[model samples]
Target chain A: MPAETTRAANRERLAARRAAEAAARAQAERRRRTVLGGVVAAVAVLVALVAVIVVQTHRTSTSANAAVPANTVDGTVISVGSADAPVTVDLYEDFQCPNCKAFEDASGRTVAQLVADGTVQAHYHGMAFLDTSANGRYSTRALNAAAVVVATAGPGAFQAFHDLLFANQPVEGGSGLTDAQLVQYATQAGAAGSSVEHDIRNLTYGDWVKTATDQASKDGVTATPTVFVDGHKLADLSSAGLTSAVTAAAAG
Target chain B: MRWNAATAGPWLGTAARLVLGGVFVVAGALKVPDPGAAVRAVRAYRLLPESLVAPVAFGLPVIEIAVGLALLLGVFVRTASIAAAVLLVVFLVGVGSAWARGLRIDCGCFGNGGEVTAGETAYPLEVLRDAALVVVALLLARWPASRLALGGRSVAGTTDRKEYSRAR
Candidate 1:
């Protein structure tokens, strides 16, 4: 009887130990799954946050680009000097570019003096690379419209519009000149009638602006204020360099 | 978990090792030439914050080289395979995000800056490719093509042959 009892006790002890081990393993597995689920949830939240940030940044960039005013210019292309001039200088520039404005402020007067004296013919074509986001309020549209006004209303309007654009080059990526502001500039430049208003609403000069940009690209111009004198490239568009190039081109 | 040379098929294991090794070597080589460009490319994705960009850009190539070498040499084959699989998963996620956003930028994977349309660059295809690699990596991790490896031989010699033979 005692032997049978001892055998039964041993069997019971083995069964209990097995049951305890199984429960321990089950608890461990549950803990592991919980930890893994928490980790996955955390990672998912992190990924979502990153996605939101990226989208917001892209949205801001696009909206900012879209906010700049459109152009409102009119006119026919005109030669800046007499046809008998020795050198022809073509300057492709964006008004919003500081460098372009600087080139104009520094070398513009000298070029004008030369042109007035019949030593050179300066043909200016305004390009619009910085029209997207660089010029906060003034876009390619506004610049192109201004070009049309200069073409129609004459050199006085072009020069006035040019000075105004340079003076109003917004702090990088900010809203550029509004449509109303552009009309004010045109009025100041002696542009008459509803021409500026008409061009702004109709986007009349968009094709011309695109063609000018394409021409600039074909000419191997990448940056702003690219000055080409009689098909010869100058290293810098500064007064000294431009004057020297024009003098050389005139002599050649 | 006794391992033996006889348990893993030599031909299959060697092929997997060569393929995985070639992939890493090619990827690493493509990125090694212009580290700065690679950094810029990653930044353009705008996935990683500015803070994490430098570290990831600098360390990624080195890790890829190490993983490639380890896979080719068959040293730490299992660990290397796991690491490669994890990297592929991360890459898939990034590519998937760009595709979802309708971005028309290059994958910049090989660092050539070749742009592709969002429609052309599908997230599922990238995920499928990575998944295929993951399968191969899992196989390598499980079977461990160690017959030709120095570590494999040492491990096989020390382990009980009878137990592994039965398990295989």
Candidate 2:
């Protein structure tokens, strides 16, 4: 073959190889994009999810802080009856616990009777440890409102309000009673007013509730409605048993 | 990816995704409604820095939900699988630590975790469950070319071309 023919053949073969290489490169780029696009999308979504969670968590905590006044340092162990009563009846309870409500129903009146009779000085340690067991911070809100009533209206109003709370205890896994309902209950117990309503709504004693709950846990009171009579934890946890134990402690 | 596809690729991945994704979705959703409980549950573990507890409690559920949704949709199977594996590992550590420390508490994977009266802690079962999840996650991550994946394609062609280039 002539030199010209050989050169033409070489050019065609080189051009064909270059076209094949370009096609392969384009295909590779498309594949890489496809693979990477999914990962990038996932990362972006995950980042967005985290941002939302952070914002929400911040809102709840900040609102909690806002609810408690800076001046009020801590929630207290609200007590009732004569301070010099022979026996001390300590009750650890939560507003949101159904079992606590049951305990209150079974033995609350008896304890109240004891408190009224001046046989023992009853100390109620209401905690918000069950805050997560329900929706919308029901435990904290209820306990906080109870604290306000106890603080302002004294133990008599607290007993009335406490009974009303259990009487209308909302179901678990719900937003539970709203602020308005809480204020209404407080009012019925003769503890409601503008500032008092504000206290209930803002969760004025929320921090105290938290502190008290922490203290309870540290004190080894895990579950709700833990009754202690003269420093002894009631093991039976029954209404009759609780009353009888209190009576025994008082007698001694 | 293609090699795995030829076997039980998408089917296996889908099954794993469904089981893991379903459980995580339920677990996370149940907690989302009540962040406080989630925090308490984290506190019960007695692991993690105090400052980190709330963030983890809040973020873990969101992460679980996101990964679970991604897996259920089959959109980014590999990434979701990796996330699932990471989540399971963290859970295993928490459950293991709680067991080692003799903390009688619920694992808090779903709702109603944290402190219990007595005889309610189920650490070994929780750990075993998480271990199984980790295995499934790793398997799916290793072979993410499952059936009906959103953007799944065989990587065999790419693998072959590298060999072809090396030969050249």
lDDT of each: 0.63, 0.76
Interface RMSD of each: 14.2, 3.9
Best candidate, lDDT = 2
Model 1: per-residue Cα lDDT over B44-91, one tens digit each = 555787777645654566566667776887766777788888887788
In candidate 2, which residue ranges exceed 4 Å CA deviation? A1-54, A62-73, A81-90, A106-123, A127-141, A167-222, A227-235, A239-252, B1-9, B29-33, B73-76, B96-106, B111-132, B152-168
Per candidate, the number of residue pairs that clash is: 21, 3
Q: List, for all models, the DockQ compared with the true complex.
A: 0.03, 0.28
Model 1 off-target regions past 4 Å? Answer: A1-78, A133-137, B1-168
Of the true interface contacts, each candidate retains a share of 0.00, 0.24
A63-163 in candidate 2: lDDT tens per residue? 33434322122345777788888889888887878877888888888888888788888888777755543457888899889888877787778879988
- CA lDDT of A64 in candidate 1? 23
Scored against the true structure, residue A32 in model 2 reaches a CA lDDT of 90
